[model samples]
Target: MKIEAHEVERRVETFKAAVQEAGLKLTHQRLEVFRELASSADHPDAHGIYDSVKHRLPTVSLDTVYRTLRTLSDLGLINMLGTAGESIRFDANTRKHHHFVCVNCGLVRDFENEELSALQVQEDLVGFGRVLETQIEVRGICNDCRNKS
Candidate 1:
């Protein structure tokens, strides 16, 4: 998606509001960390986030990244995912979407099939509660990785 600068600013404000709503203090470091996650197309892990921001913030610690990731995930600002025996990664997009994980490289990519969401679940399947989130994570080797093998 081609996000405009104005949109980025708007999102920043939205994030701040969310933080405030959660009774959290808005700090510069937190904003920077949250912005990176919100703006990134890649759903990177804590390590990836630390690596990306380390250049700008020489003194930023890994602990800060981990804490921010947890806070953001709790605030519904990002989605966190983890594969079997793999590190957790974050997705900035908050809209209902699914993911496709490349087992070969452990890369997580967004995959949306409208038909899946359009389908209705059986009443018996969810007897007591309503569906709040419907995210699917499919694991397989990516085409590029498969071709390389």
Candidate 2:
């Protein structure tokens, strides 16, 4: 899907009230990192985030970006996506959606195949009755990238 900058700005705007509710300062670095996440389709990692915002904030460290990403992920404002042998990728779309990853180029794109989401999960824990989280990452070649080979 083609998500635009305005759409991203709107999403971050939704977080302003909640950010304060969490007693967070919502500093310049925080906002800048989030805004970049919102606008990106690259499925960035902490290093990628640092690269994007470094020009504006030269001293922003890689550790700062990682910490911010963890905060955002904990706040339910973003998603940390990764596969069995991949670097952690940050997703701004916190919604329950799947992704198709390109093994060759490491490109990530939103996957909308609803049938996969409908698959059943086996519940085997007899005593534990609480379920709080589920994350699925599907791997494959993207259409354009597949066609190029």
Per-model TM-score, in order, reads 0.78, 0.80
Candidate 1: clashing residue pairs, number: 0
Q: Taking the tens digit of each residue's C-alpha lDDT, what string does model 2 give over 1-149?
A: 44686878787887676688888899999999988887887888899888989998888999999999899888877888755687788888765677767887788876555676676665644667654444456677878877898
Question: Candidate 1: which pairs clash?
Answer: none
Clashes of each: 0, 0
> How close to the true structure is residue 14 of candidate 2, measured as C-alpha lDDT?
70
lDDT of 2: 0.79
**Lowest-lDDT window of 10 residues in candidate 1?**
1-10
Q: Pick the candidate with the highest lDDT.
A: 2
Over the full model, what C-alpha lDDT does candidate 1 score relative to the true structure?
Answer: 0.77
RMSD of each: 3.3, 2.9
